[model samples]
Target: MNTTPDSIRHVALSTVRLPLAVPISDAKVFTGRQKPMTEVIFLFAEITTEQGHEGLGFSYSKRAGGPAQYAHAREVAEGLIGHDPSDIAKIYTQLLWAGASVGRSGVATQALAAIDVALHDLKAKRAGLPLAKLLGSHRDSVRTYNTSGGFLNASIEEVKDNATRSLEAGIGGIKIKVGLPDTAEDLRRVAAVREHIGPDVPLMVDANQQWDRTTALRMGRALEEFDLTWIEEPLDAYDVEGHARLTRSLDTPIATGEMLASVAEHERLIDERACDIIQPDCPRVGGITQFTRLLTLADRAGLDLAPHFAMEIHLHLAATYPREPWVEHFDWLDPLFNETLETRDGRMILPERPGLGVTFSDQARAWTTDAVEFGIR
Candidate 1:
């Protein structure tokens, strides 16, 4: 390892599994299983420079397989040693091709996402600036919509109560899960929640890619009266043609892309005019560098930004988004991190602390199932 403080000397990967306080469900909750636990994996990466400065980053999985992602992260870290922490793009390219045989998405990109995020965190920390400031701040805080209260498993009354509580907490936007077995029941839920939240509060719904083109159109059209912000993942994630057709048919915008893996795929979505709101997840999309490319593309296309999970990471990215951004709120992650995300008047305030500005909780550390490190001794 180089003696210089800026040189990359070591990388560490740690894996932790967190169980959802409530077993959250969407339309596709049971892809095959009759029942499943709502647990997720948090894979964290810390890239340390020779001077003892460390940059933190992480990725997550709703499904099982933390070990596989951790293994891939370790493999990616091996090739990153000896490079400058500032070589994010170069290192990103190297890791991108290294996992090409496994395709550009999935576990490989999840690993690369960790590296890219940590590198950016490292860079921003070295500059001693908030990530958004380092990336060029566009807004003080981004608007946030609460999704934690609207899970499918909750009753209609529970849904209304959740919405009311969100409003009481100063959050003005709320999202709920739709695509229930009965369309009427789904409409009823939407109606009840909308009524509870009132006319001005923005409401959004997600089908979790459970519907085909026809059903998405029919249900989306019916639910339009509720004045939704957007209908997310109404069709399959890859059904660009279907999404375009639905997007054109509906007055309510169709938002998707959380399942998407690369900038190329996002380009296809944008080029096809698949949806009005582009929802990209940073860890799922190969980290901030790739996400920023999509953010720029979305901006040029006149599309809105509403990134999916991991609000801690997206809060900074969205704060600097060229357009006003809507970040989803999932309090499910509160137990996983050291810091609390400050929210006021329906918006999230970014932390001024250096880098990603948060660390794993000691309780979260106790959940670590596997840990590994790579670099010079």
Candidate 2:
């Protein structure tokens, strides 16, 4: 253990399982690409410096691979025990090589997401500033939208009700899942929701990458009349060329990139001008350091930003974008944190608290399935 005055002294890891209220389905599930999602698994990292300065960060997996992230992180996180706490990027590189044999993307980097995020949180907390301010922010709040209430599993009436509730709750936009096998039914749901929310509200639709080229174009054209803010993931996430074709052929904007796990992959989409809006998931892309690299490219390409989930971590990231941006709102993670995010006037406000401004709730601790620690506390 490091006895140096400013070096890292303690590192702890916990695997927590959060069970969903219901098994949620999207276009991918209906198409048999994957099963419904029943729970979200998190790999949390808490680091303490010798001076008692602390930071908390986490990464998560869905459907499968929870144990892989935990196991991988367990093997490599100890490398941080004696390093300087403020050298975040350097520390991430060290961990990368510590586990180089397993490769650098997917589960490998995803596991490192917790440590990277925690280091940022620790540094920000030490500075006593909100993460956005520490990173340099452009706005105090980002445009907000909701996707949890409008899943494909819900009925048309349920979709309308969810949209109404979300709007009444002060959210500025609504997003609903599309890409059902039955194209007409998808249109019917869009039409009903559009009518319910009215033309003034900004509405987006996600296809979850369930469409082929022909269907994506056809559906994109048909969706134009609804006045959609954008048509999301109409084709596969990897179909940059196809997305470029659709981006040109249709009036509605194309949005994708959430499924991609590395900044290198997003660079291809940005350089090719594949989509109008680029959505990235921070935890999926190896946390804030990697996410910050992506933001620079996205800002240069002038692509609109709307990160995919974990609004707690993304609100700060979105606030730093040079352009106006949006953040997805899902109550799914609310049970895991002690605090609630404020939404009003169609935006999610930045927290004044240091770091990510979140602390794990008792429910989160109760949900911990495994734990490990290194160094003296």
Candidate 3:
């Protein structure tokens, strides 16, 4: 670590709301559990050290709670003003304690995530190395797949068209939303997508925790013929025992954990042998610090890794996984950054640029709904 006092001199936080082209409906929306998600709310943290080094990181929420994350971040970010930006784990603990009243997981950890990630980005930038290189990369590229194109809102034709375009663009796999109320409809959609993409391409489906055990099993069996890569979140996120049972019963690999907010929650899934693949979202699991901890545990259990979102950050983190990993490709976030990630032959190539390999675009600033800052810069 750089011993120079290059203390974090400023922390600028902003809330950017990115609108989807259309209302995104998943199983959650169709099940009446939540309304269609029209936007993704982000808490962006831009941290600067006294030495002039800077880093940018962001966390996001879907449907609601954007304000709460921003408010919580604003409250705790003050503590980072004089701290060495390289002491990521220590600073993460301090922020967690700063907001101890709200407990350690969910929104509290999520809010801290942006700060945690920003610190990592700063440390990597200061070293003049890409974040993946800073973290010890296992590979420069990770298998990539597209999820933004495969939502329940789109019809079979739309889904097929999206898959065709995505493949042409170099995405390696296709994943479509499943678990609509009608099982037959879900099957028909999956069948159509499989037929369109052909069996040679990787295909996966997400249930978004909308299915009961019986339904998940039945669908799991029915979808088996398609030779899916994995079935994601077929049961509730916390249903470790349920997931374990389903995992044991199905030949298809089970993937979950994006909804988990902390390392301990994921520990349950890893300990109990719940799933074959683990999909931890960096921001949602409290940024790279906690996400790395989960990766160690998942690796020991011999589980496959496929980080959920935020390809800008996950691309670096996933590249470091001991085992080859998959990074989800969502073009929705493409406009937020001035640099774009490349996908070819179904893999996301880690950017050679230092830190998270991205700089905020003017559009990101234009979408800012709120902003706050702490300390001098």
lDDT against the true structure, per candidate, is 0.86, 0.93, 0.93
Of 1 and 3, which scores higher on lDDT?
A: 3
TM-scores of the models, in the order given? 0.96, 0.98, 0.98
Task: For residues 1-377, write the lDDT of model 3, one tens digit per residue.
Answer: 65667888999999999988999999998999999889999999999988899999999998678899999999989999889887898999999998999999989999999988889999899899999999999998999999999999998899999999999999999999998999999999999999999989999999999999999999999999999999999999988999999999999999999998889999999999999999999999899999998989999999999999899999999999999889999999988999999999888888999999999999999999999988997
Q: Could you give the candidate ranking by TM-score, starting with the highest?
A: 3, 2, 1
Residue-level lDDT tens digits of model 2 in 8-43: 999999999999998999999999988999999999
Clashing pairs in 2: none
Which sections of candidate 1 miss by over 4 Å?
Answer: 1-5, 30-34
Off by more than 4 A, model 3: 1-3
Q: What TM-score would candidate 2 get against the native? A: 0.98
Residues 1-377, candidate 1: write the lDDT tens digits. Answer: 34454778888889888888877777776343335457889899888887777888998888765677788878768888888888889999898887778888778888788889999998888888989999998997889999888888888888888888877776769999987767788888888888877889999999888787788889988988988999999988999999999988989988999998788989999999999999999998889988988888999999999999899899999998888889898888898788988889988888889988888789888888888888864
lDDT value for candidate 2? 0.93
Query: After superposing candidate 2, which stretches have Cα over 4 Å from the reference?
Result: 1-5
